[model samples]
Target: MNASLKLLPLAIGAALAVLPAAYAAQDNVQTLSNFKTTGNTKPAETVPQTGTRADALRENLKAIKLPPGFKIELYAVVPEARAMTIEPSTGVVFVGTRKDRVWQVTDRTKRRVADDVVQFASSVTFKVPNAVCFSPDGVLYIVEQNRVLAFPAAQFFGEGGPDVAAAVVVPQGKLIPTQFESFNHGARYCRVGPDKKLYIALGQPWNVPPKDKLAELDKNGLAGIIRMDQNGKNREVYAHGVRNSVGLDFNPKDKSLWFTDNQVDGMGDDIPPGELNHATKAGANYGFPWYGGGHVRTEEYKDQTPPAGVVFPMVEYAAHAADLGMSFYTGKMFPEKYQGGIFDAEHGSWNRTKPIGARIMFTPVKDDGSVGETEVFAEGWLTPNGEYMGRPVDVQQLQDGSLLVSDDYAGAIYRISYAK
Candidate 1:
């Protein structure tokens, strides 16, 4: 039986070509093939890289305040840009949006600015495809609201027709149970860890889940970070009790996992601070409902005795800041002090009476792997009138040591570079 199974692939390939009419009628066999994707007939759409809209976004940068010799410019005009993953080998950037489209931005002439921006893998209908990450081997993993797809050699396939080769890592409705899915807090994030395991952040679909759903949420891998083999096998919870973590990366020095947690709201704005947590080992719990953020207790689980050994944030951000994607500085273009630090984007506050945190923050890392206090690296997205000119979603470092910041509100990506 084992030997027959080994030969089944060859037999199936042969059968599909030479089999009788009745055998060819088996549509289910073709549908079940790993190569299948929900293909569309529509041609790929290219976003205009230079236009009035792009100029307006660039002009808005004049209002931005940066340090000494740093400057920001419009890199590309990607609508609703949310999360970004870059292929180091090709320098191609894959950006995900809250909507269905994933964009491919390329600088064909080796210029720092992108030459073209177009929809990637338009054949596949991605639902809230807001998070994307690439493995060192250049495999692109797009984490949608309810599915995860891996495109082998996406840097090349993305340039071809809409029918790019896609492998289902986690099929639709299988990453999480159907009943637990919700649109709110549904934008997922993932990374290929140093161990080569795929780590994904799953947000619980509530301000705070009721006590009844706690057990099931924990059991089903919600409200936590889960890790699995690259092919999506042997999945297990790596961390628990996270409310909603939008950004995560590994510390190259020590290989520890660090993630940003968006805290609960409606608690009068300043009690529970946002979080940048360090997970040194597996099964660590970042306090959530029991403690909203930091040590502040939530109204829902205020009276309950919290679990022992709950890990807290390594650095606490201001409340309601909406901290999102983060990346460790592993580049040489930046000065000595900026090396090994972290750059995190604050998407800004939605409900605060006085809005804050539409900026990029920097946290210095000591040689021992401990973190220092975070400071505003760049600002002016939040105007004095308490309005957001642009909301930065994620920060990605390019191979040249420049940084790319995606703003969903501005529907653009900006490049930040330094000059001595």
Candidate 2:
């Protein structure tokens, strides 16, 4: 009868807790009372936010708070935009989503306002193609639910659209082992690291899986980040024990890995917090089932001993923030104080009693290259009445030193620029 239980994907929590494990694994997917995710169902009368009205959207932008001399503008109207990457040559921004399409926002006149917003590859059948990045050579890479793809001519030659027949890099069912596909936590966020290797995140499907599944999880490279050669050869696990990291970027200063993890939910309203994790090198494991968010132990794995030498998070944020896409600011547009900092998107909480974190946050890199605590950069999406006008899903910086923040809820991408 708990209010939060109604928001779960399956039956109420109390009812599921008493069910046998055999029945729980009938579909080979386990759902726990404490492991339920924020479901996708909305109220019957929930109006669709398609981001079609430009003038009305600009009026709402007046309320967002940013540091002085900085301004926000309506860049492009992209529905379901999750993570994005920019093509340096043409100034086209490629955006990915959990839906079946990838969007391209172009500024042909160099006016900063996007005049063209269209689907990149209308011919290809995309399934949750939600993360995108560009190589130094201008090749566009898309990481999806079940595979990885590359478009060598994505910028110049493929301007008309991708040729799906020749653009397959990592084929279908090869991203994961194929046995672990589920509707939950398969958001693939990826990029080409400074070392020129392609890094991809494969999230574990269960909320808090049983202890017996850890070895298989490791074997399948779920709950971890993996990297490989540009041709998808010699793929290896880079970091492990990460629970659903939808955002990741290399520190421009160090070229090492840093990411945002959506921690285990349903532990109460405010026990465990969202995490900004860092790994000095490959083969490091950030704590997951043993220590859910920070060091807060989940009720399921409180008794079992976690593997030793587990790495902890560097920066922590408010619980249920759903921190998704992030990038480090290496541009010259923002003030000197804002340089070399990290910008992240908190997609907001769904099941919490009081919803929080429909905002964009910033964290500065210290003098010694350490990460600092999070500070709100752009907010006002979640209104005073706990309703969402927009939910920021990702953040990207362009060649002109401005920033792009995508909101899947409002279905628009806003441009942030600095004048002074």
lDDT, candidate 1, 104-186, per-residue tens: 99999877999999999876667899889988777788998877767767888778767665555666677888788898889
How would you encode candidate 2's per-residue C-alpha lDDT over 1-420 as one tens digit per residue? 222113222322323444345633431113222333223132211123234476677888887888899899988877787899999777898889898888877788988888777776554557899989887766678988987766554654335433321234566677887778888997799899899888998898898877788888877679988898766768898998988999999887778889999999888888689999888988988988888899899899899888889998888889998999999999999998889999999999997999999999999988576767679998888899999888999899988899999989877889999997
Q: After superposition, how far is residue 73 of candidate 1 from its true place, in Å?
A: 0.7
RMSD of each predicted structure: 5.2, 12.7
Taken over the whole model, the C-alpha lDDT of each candidate is 0.85, 0.79
Q: Highest lDDT: give the candidate number.
A: 1
Superposed Cα deviation of residue 373, candidate 2 (Å): 3.5
